[model samples]
Target chain A: MPIVDLANPSRFLALTARLMPWLIGATVLAFAVGLVMVKGAPDDYQQGATVKIMFIHVPSAWLAMGIWALMAIATFGTLVWRHPLADVAAKAAAPIGAAFTALCLITGMLWGRPMWGTYWVWDARLTSVLVLFLMYLGVIALWRTVEDPSRAARAAAILTLVGALNLPIIKWSVDWWNTLHQPASVVRLAGPAIHPTILMPLLAMAVAFLLLMVTLHLAAMRNEILRRRVRTLMLMQAQAAPGSAS
Target chain B: MSALAALFVREVRLAVRVGGGGGIGALFFLIVVVLTPFAIGPDLALLARIGPAILWLGALLASLLTLDRLLTADLEDGSLDLILMSDTPLELAVAAKAFAHWITTGLPLVVITPLLGLLLNLDAGASAAVALTLFAGTPALTFIGAIGAALSVTLRRGGLLLAVLVLPLTVPVLIFGVAASNAAIVGPVPFGTPFTILCALTLASLVVGTFAAAAALRQGME
Candidate 1:
């Protein structure tokens, strides 16, 4: 009965404590191989070494979109199941998503300036990405600015879902508008255009980025749980000082 | 309908006595339009080219400045509870309030646009186009911005959050609004497509965000 009752935090924490080292080990292994592949990939026939930015840019862009989707699902989960952790999951995700979004933007600029001869362009894809970056920062800033944690979570969740609705619009806006940004090359109808030589490392980096995101998400969740615990303890102490502990 | 009309009147009266939200929003739009030419360089041809877009964007930003007030005042003073309990569907009340908000903030921008258009050197045709687009576009902003307002009603600092959350969703409107005005000048395409899309965006916002916001408000009041 005691073992099955692991829904309690103390039990959950004990289990997680035992599990952390393994997750950390796996993350390190994935990143190490991923970094080597990224560094060693042949220069692009067209873009030259600047194409290496693709290794980071593609994954970060993917994660930037993926995290928002995850946050929306977490939000809908909280609204439906009233899951205690779902709110925390969303609140913790804002910064990580913002970080990936920032990485995507920075790497995108590095690639863009060299190829397009400008740091910024009003192309549909770039414009959509810029909006995504702004949305992420807004989510992060909103979560931090609010005094009430639960109110912040709900607000952030609404923002997340709203931003998620635009991801499809942004991705397709280029195709729909036929602007400067190219349509999907790697994920196209005839499959990836790049030779397997480059494709293998790109896939590896993507897997590594996902693994790293999971690690950060777990750590962020732990930090949130700790913050909540301290807040509860502070409230209890505030009440207890005027009355008996019982 | 009368019940919602009553709420709309009450909201507008409250807005007016609270220092006039829409007028201030229009003032912001005028200031942005006036200041942009010096910075972008004072070429009337260039100004004429971009005037519609600048006016539409200015309206979007200015309307954003007022969106936070939509629910914050009600939430703060406890009127939100009464609104929640009314037998009228909260969605209808949202529409009515949003309609009033548009009248206050958006109408002023539409009225004052030609005045600002002179500063930007926009011709009469483009000015008319700007007014028409702003008139169409700003309602959609209110409708969409209301959802963010409703979501962030309980927060102390929802103003910036509302802008960040709402602006991207607003791109479709801004695009078509300006495009319609541009079409008026260029004659490459008719204004029908952009104008129809703007109407569609407004309707979608009303149907979706309205109900979503009302549902959330109901939850909070409970």
Candidate 2:
């Protein structure tokens, strides 16, 4: 079937059911390979074993930012295209995105304790990420506080799009003001700065994390659809009952 | 009067008559600034050092305090529906309301900052520096708060929620406002750099807040 056919909720559910096992298997396999690679990779001369934390920390950080970008696109789907599943997708991604952001923050603190010799610093990258975490919570709170899911979704779509625009400005302003965080080494013009031996495991772990995020997101979307259906049925039952007030 | 000017006058008049606009925000700003000394002790040097930061924070919060009424008052009285169906564009209408809110609410906080700065032991130069930044910066706060105001327009008890939603987004404005004031007071770096960025942030928020709040109101009113 063409991809657009999956816009139907039932069709989407069927596709996810069919795709779930393979996705799970791949994620598990990827994580296994990544862990083995990480075990064999030599420690950094300076950081020693502490460098191993990068495998977990970096990927979660990537997912933290990546998931927001994903939600921004989903928000566009909701607002512009009026795609039925788009709001569900955006809503589902929020808490999962929040979890990854929290994981990123916690793991970064763990790493920083050894590297920066403090649990936290108001470094540009670190502070911006914390702001991102707060934004996620704010969006989720907006979703929860509004009684109607559809209304909340539209409101959240606006907030998400604005956030996507503001995020770059926040990053730039923070970087301009002060920065103690390390500069980009992986994505810079000169290319990957690390030796391939370490880079391989990092890439593997990143893929594993991506797979994990997708799996969780799809499952969460399915759950939200089911929950909405149950809500519809309950309302129907209430309306059908005897002596119900209009 | 032009349609936008009429709307502007209506908002200012309503805020003035409604009894929550003129002095409430400035009073909150004063209390917040006064509380700082009690919380942080009466050390003049330390208060002088952090004076700009305190003033910026107080203005940010006072604007948020008054932002909830920006759209809700109209929405409650059913005039928002009338405004929505009117010939003037919603974007201009939202901007007009926000500007009125700044005049009645945010402007007072700016006018009172120098006096409040004295409570923080700020010198005359430091007070003027902070007041200047607040003048340039609080419009950004009012506009940013407008987005949250519009988003929460339909909800009950939305003020606290509006604060949560808008505060993080105002970080850039806060950072640069305080930075510029500090730079003006203690000048290793030129004040022009941060002050210029502060102005840019206000301009950007004016465009962003107008469109976003208008969009939110459109979605919400349905």
Candidate 3:
């Protein structure tokens, strides 16, 4: 089994309990440090203060891809192992991915306006990210729409895995065709040779984003459990009523 | 065998015969196109600049309006159950439904794009690109929408949910469709890259989406 049976609810709770406070601390601490460093960095010789948005924009972009990939792993777990936690985790991760994607878009637009002289341009990278954002929204929407939980989870899992199709398209969109959004910098075919000053804060921001996502994912999984518990309780209450129909 | 085909045709015919105007889709499309000039400004130059993109966005939205009804009506009336039990595999049935759906909604948009293009002030080349992309892309719309439709097929009042689900999955086609047209309309970029990308996305969706929807339909039946 690729996944050990993880349905033991106490184990999930125990794991999240141990992980949550550390994730919360790491995220808050890193955000504070990263913010200070970004604010203190000397203005770019070329773009100046507006370029500062890159600290936020780039990290969100990294997490947007990272979270989608994480969702794919969860989806694979559900589809192959029929692991119950996998469905909950994938469902839990979507809104966070959507939030990250939206953050990426807003920051991109802010960064673009000064650089491109337009708030929004339909460049390939921007357009592909927008597509990815919509994909996140769609998967979340489908998960909520269905009445049967198991079926919805399976369908949404399938979609999560399938929509991973957009990842490479997004990464390559700038290079694959002409676009205003510049191609990858710290990440490139050549690899990370970016100046250390810029690279260090960027790495810190990535750590912050990862920790934030993990905290939110645990919160969301907790929420799912509560929602299901409530649903089950309501079912029991309805059944208890003398005239209730099953 | 023909009876299965007939049932599929009946679904298509019923949709057309109920015809409230086909206007909701076209009107939604026209309204989106119509609003762009006001919102983006009366610059014919700006409108012309973004025209193909506006058209592609409008077409994708218009196509979505038809999806809520794609599976709901049949599932409600119990016709879907009979189709499930019929000799035709659900995949073929789905492919047929998708074909019929394209005929009703997508085909009209494809036909009317040229007329709409003139209104948007798109030139001859951009209009052709719009037509070509719409032709290639809407079948993907039907197929993708079918899966969303199937997933929500069992629910009452599933329309808004349908939009939320399908819109994201359809984004690639929307991006490439607009890009293909935008390339020719907007600049020095070669058109072939986006055009080929659009074709590949549509073909991929046609295969994967078809199977997913078929599996969903079977699940619904059982």
Candidate 4:
């Protein structure tokens, strides 16, 4: 089907309904394989067992940032193209993205207690991620507070685009400031720093998380479309009933 | 006067009228500063050390206090619809409103900072440094806050939500503003470095905030 055909809510819903089972199956399969690989992966000579947290922590962090980038693109669709699903995609992505960001922070804190010897520090990486998390909450709150979906979407799109300014700052923060959080290892210009023993599982886990995010986002978008339908039906019913004008 | 200048003047005039919230922000700033010492006790050394941060935090919260009025007042009285229909580009008009808001609400905080600083036991030079940073930085706060104001203008009670939406975006300004003040007060790092970044942030936010706020206002009206 042509891409524009998916612009129809019913068509989009149908597509997601067909795609979800496969997506969920893939996500489960990927996680299973990723976890098994992670179990077999060697313990760090320095970090020891604490290194295992990276399997989850790093992927959540990636998705935390990656989801915002996805929303930014969806926002462009919202403001520029006025694509019907754009705002839905952006709105649906928010709470799920926020969950990943919170997961990233909590797991990082867990990793830090053993590695950095503290639950929290005002280091550049940590601070920027915290700021990212806060922005996610702000976006979600904006979504919840506005009663009108389209207006809320436009406002959120603007805010999301503006918030996108922080992405580069967060990405470059480790280089810009000599913070306690270590710099990029996996996706650096210098290439993968870790041996395949660890790198393979990290990649697998990241794929699994990406698939999971897609599945969850599609499910949320479907529910939102249904909710809007219910709202419209209820409003029409109220208007049709006698003495309901007041 | 030209349309933009006329709009700017009207905004400033409206802000100073009775119950305009022109002075409330500064009053809030003073109260925040005064309450700090009471909470932290009168350790002059400690106050002097952390004075700039408290001052910046006070200014940050104070600027937020009246932001809801930026567009909501015009929106409520139906003047905002007229402004929207006028030939003046919405972006420039929004910028003008934000500039006027800074003059009325933000300027008072900067002017009163040195006095508030004294209560915190901050010395003359330290207070001056903070005031200077505030002078350069608070416009960014107002402009950034404008986006939140415009976003929440239609909501019946948007004050707290506006604060939540705007504060995280203001983090960089807070960081650099405090860093510059600290640099001037006591620093191995030169004052020029972070001070320059703060000014740059203000400049960047001026453009970003204006455009984004304008876009949000236009979208909200529809």
Question: Cα miss at A194, model 2 (Å)?
Answer: 1.5
Q: Which lDDT value does model 1 have at B85?
A: 79
Q: Between candidates 1 and 2, which one is better according to TM-score?
A: 2
lDDT of each: 0.79, 0.91, 0.78, 0.90
Candidate 4 per-residue lDDT over residues B55-147, each given as its tens digit? 999999999998998998798899999999999999999999999999999999999999988888888999999999999999999999999
TM-score of chain A of 4: 0.95
Pick the winner on lDDT between candidates 2 and 4: 2
Q: Kindly list the per-residue Cα lDDT of model 4 for residues A1-246, writing each as its tens digit.
A: 998889999999999999999999999999999999999999999999889999999999899989999999999889888876988899999999999999999998998898878999777777778889989999999999999888889989988998998557444533344465566678888889988898999999999999999999999999989988998999899989998765
Q: For candidate 3, lDDT tens digit of each residue in B99-179?
A: 877887888888888888888888888898889889988888888888778767776766877777777677667767877
Report the lDDT tens digits of candidate 1 across residue range A1-246. 475455455555666677788888888998899889888889988899998889999999899888888899998856766655778889888889989988898888888999999887777877777778777887887778766677667666766776676567545543334388766679888889889889999999999899889888878887888898999999788878866666
What is the two-chain DockQ of model 2?
0.85
In candidate 3, position A146 carries an lDDT of 73
Q: Model 2 over residues B30-113: C-alpha lDDT tens digits?
A: 889889988999999998898898888888888888888788768888999999999999999999999999999988888898
Q: Give the distance in Å from residue A230's predicted Cα in candidate 3 to where it truly belongs.
A: 3.1
After superposing candidate 1 on the true structure, give the runs of residues whose Cα lies further than 4 Å from its correct spot.
A1-12, A170-178, A243-246, B13-22, B187-189, B219-222
Candidate 2 residue-pair clash tally: 0
Q: Once superposed on the true structure, which residue ranges of model 2 sit more than 4 Å away at CA? A: A244-246
Clashing residue pairs, candidate 3?
A: none
**Best to worst by TM-score, what's the order?**
2, 4, 1, 3
Q: Write down the C-alpha DockQ for each prediction.
A: 0.48, 0.85, 0.34, 0.62
TM-score of 4: 0.97
Pairs of residues clashing in candidate 1:
none
lDDT of 1: 0.79
Considering DockQ, where higher is better, how would the candidates rank from best to worst?
A: 2, 4, 1, 3
- Which lDDT tens digits does candidate 3 get at residues A12-59? 777778888888888899899888877776677788777678788888
Please state the error at residue B99 of candidate 1 in Å.
Answer: 1.5
